[model samples]
Target chain A: MTHAFYVALSYAASGIVVAVLVGWTLLDGRAQQRALKELEAAGIRRRSAARDQAEKKA
Target chain B: MSEPIPAIKKFSDLANPTIFLGLTARIVPFLAVATALMFAFGLYLAFTTEGDYQQGETVRIMYVHVPAAWLSMMCYSIMAASALGTLVWRHPLADVSAKAAAPLGAGFTFLALVTGSLWGKPMWGTWWEWDARLTSVFVLFLMYLGLMALTRALDDPAKSARVAAVLILIGFVNIPIIKFSVEWWNTLHQPASVMRMDGSAIDGEFLRPLLVMAGAFTLLFFTLHFLAIRNEIWRRRVSAQRRLAARMANRES
Candidate 1:
């Protein structure tokens, strides 16, 4: 190719950084959702949520 | 008969984490697709466009470098606004927005620096320069990192957000300096070309692709930001639930 090595490196670096950012965010979201699900399975509900349900019933 | 009004009626309704997360889940996917399409088109244009007479194919680096640089600043500006939200109105999502933005700002700054160095090596015959523009941006990267560390180092969300908001506001002074660095001092970096007051100095051939790519990058930034914010909200919910469970267990014991 007519392009220099630096040009290639720049693109590759950008790609890698962007990919990592997207991947990390996706994984973090999954982990947080999983944690919430586990807590829910353990019957650990947020106080605010419990209060809201009680208020609705009342 | 009047229809039943929804709970979330105005901008303030988004302050509710559940509402914010619900809306973001819908919006981010659209943004993600649009960003991808724009990037694809922009890359095509970037590759097909003629090289600069002076800089040759190396000018393609500008496609990536300039957008990254512009975004590096834009991301900080967003965080500064979020800081205001945190300190002023005390909006619930304010600190969430700021906290989510810090790492992304660092990432954009890192891209700007590395890509600028790559361009400089071929054109300026140097890999790095300590000129005003470069130095200011480097300082910005550090500021972002420092803010991130401060947030994590402090366990209390309320206190940490306050501290980070103050730090973000203080750090905002550097944005103007970075913007005008090439103008205010003798620097290897070029001054404003596209965003000049007297119209863009760049020719139309290069400008079009640059603009598309800029839009794409901006959309990508927002998409990631929304996703990060959604995750942050979920994380907070999990921790809060855990705390409640702990309290309940202590009462039972």
Candidate 2:
């Protein structure tokens, strides 16, 4: 094989690894946010948020 | 009257996950765009530059390899700082930062190894070697793995953070070893070229692409770190909210 192949392989491998990292972070973040949104929709709220709301009302 | 709102006045206030998440929301998009632009420019430079006098087309590998290797170590250093935050200030987000960095660090280290191997095969006529530089880097990859395993093994997040922090700091010793390994011992891997006390040994042509690539990769790392840290914060919030819901249900019953 030509030396170009080696260079291309290196770039390709790095690109794949980076894509996977980006994909995993985005997917995981989406899932976590979805779960949090679902819980909040169900009337489960953080104490801090509740307090902030009360303070704003007062 | 209700109390006045407290504005974010200092860096320490970022330790608050809610504020950090807000910051992440604001900053990550810019980082992502800058990283993408830099990568585009850097790739253009990498491909356009004339091949090295001796190495020919294979010289292109250095653009990616050097940056990956630099980030592998730089990521660990960032983790070390986060470890300190976990130990000294007990910053809530410190372990989250450190934990998020582990997989990314491992990924860069893995890239460095594989890319270096790719470069080596054409230049050195071998795919593997057992020299100082390579071995120390291999050890660094393992360290990242070990820290990640610690993060997963302990179910208690706080305890896991402390444990991982301690291990991260302990493993910090190997970083300098990896740096000086080539200079200190005989190795197939070349010693520092672009980074040196005297000055960079690289020519102007190669240096341009390499620096741009390094800057691009560094930005990308931070971009990913922020994304990962945001995810971890959300993960914690989800668990906390779930527990709160469970307690509320029990009280209702």
TM-score of chain A of 2: 0.94
Runs in model 2 deviating more than 4 A are B1-6
In candidate 1, the residue pairs with backbone N, CA or C atoms under 3 Å apart (3 or more residues apart, or in different chains) clash, namely none
lDDT of 1 by residue, B1-253 (tens): 0112236789999998877777886688799999999999999998899989998888888999989998999999999999999999999999999999999999999999999999998888898989999999999999999999998897778899999999999999999999999899999998899988899999988999899989989999999999999888888888888888889899999
Model 2 DockQ reads 0.93
List model 1 lDDT by residue over A10-42, tens digit each. Answer: 889889889988998999999998998899899
Each model's Cα RMSD: 3.1, 2.6
Instruction: Point to the candidate with the largest lDDT.
Output: 2
For the predicted complex of model 1, DockQ is 0.79
Docking quality tier of candidate 2?
Answer: high
Error of 2 at B140 (Å): 1.0
